[model samples]
Target: MSTFFSDWYYLSIRSIKQIWRPLLALIPSLFIPIFFFVVNSSSLDAFSKVPGFPPSITYRDFIAPTALFTAVFFSSGNAGIELVQDISNGYFKKLLIMPISRLTIILGRLTEVAVQAVMQGTIVVVLLLLVGVRIQTGVLGLLAIFAMLMIFAMAWSCVSMISALRTQNARLVQSLFVVVFPFLYLTTSQAPMPLLPPTFRLIASYNPVTYIIEGVRALVLTGWGNPAIWQGFLVATTLFVIMVTLTLGSFKKALR
Candidate 1:
């Protein structure tokens, strides 16, 4: 049991260090969403005056959570990219042969992803604050939002983890980057669900990403009393469980 944790610690540190070494790898994922946030919020600040939009909030406040969502969600696949590198360079097989639990290896990468979420999420939050966005729930809600985002980051990264394990093809795994577009745009990134066109409204209603966005967005625009936050927690938790299970299965298969 202690050994599992010990393995997780070292492996996680290694993964985190690699991200910071180049640093450039993390920049695009972090900044692109900020640029999007700046442009959209500036252009759509007038949209807040429209009917059916939530009251007492500007467009910047409403879309702040969505920007955070995009930043973290878009970066989730990076762990898989690292895993692919380990495979290509023969380091992964070395770890496989070591005297350690296989599950620990996977857990280590997930931990790294969680740390990445923290770093990226914090940057987004600080940027939001600088832009005059405030969290309605105060410090507690702010912390809770970070917790939920980490779960979300880990859950989404399992896609890349599974891809790296199953295909071992870097290009194929990189191609999965396209998946972020549908999940991001299909949600309430631009406008509230009620304000969306009928087709977009129906689709956003079904996308779990919508709840996750609303959940975090509520922390900024509303408060803890809003049920959207809990729904986000639920959906993100469910996704983490399902994706981690599948990832473990893939890990076991790769060992075979």
Candidate 2:
């Protein structure tokens, strides 16, 4: 088991080296969301006054978690694009020809991607604080926030890798956000579920992102616990299982 872990660790380092440059290419991705946060943070007062939401929380605090999560989501999803690129370049084939366990190859790549996800989340957190978003949960609350983001990042990275494994297409990996971003926006990004349009309210209730927003809000704000934390946890767990299963199966078939 130790040997297995060591091999996976080394392979993860290898993947990091291979993918670092392309990952750096994504520095430009933060600008748009930061711009959104600025524009929306300023408009949040009017929006909160627009109705239905509890009056105590500022719109900046309300929408901050979604922006943080978006950073993780995009970073994790894009981190896996190199997996498809490596496969196309026959790097995966070379790894397969080596004596290492196949699972290690996947796990190593995933570990590297997951680390990147946490970095992505941290960057957003820093940005949020820079723009005056505060987490009143103190030390414990801050820990919880980071823990949740990292767990979500791990789960999300696996899903991204699964997408790459299934299609082996960089375009498909890139396009995953097209589907995810719209859902995220339509959900609780702007307000609580009650303030959303009735159609969007129903959809947001079902959205996994809703749970994340709720969980984060519950931690950051003083008294806004939505029972949806369990739902987010469940969705993250389910996606992890489904993604890892499919990715391993695809890896197996690719080797065969």
- Which residue pairs does candidate 2 place in steric collision? none
Model 2: weakest 10-residue lDDT segment is 222-231
- Could you give me the TM-score of model 2 versus the true structure? 0.87
Best candidate, TM-score: 1
Candidate 2 lDDT at 247 equals 72
Q: How high is the CA lDDT of each candidate model?
A: 0.87, 0.72
* Candidate number of the best lDDT: 1
Model 1: runs farther than 4 Å from truth? none
Per-residue lDDT of model 2, residues 1-256, tens digit only: 8988999989889877754676556675565567777788886667766667778778888778777777666666655687888789998789889888877877787676667666666778888888788887766776676666666666677766777777788888888877767767777877887777789888888877777767777777752354555556566667667766677777755555
Q: Candidate 2: how many backbone clashes?
A: 0
Q: After superposition, how far is residue 61 of candidate 1 from its true place, in Å?
A: 0.8
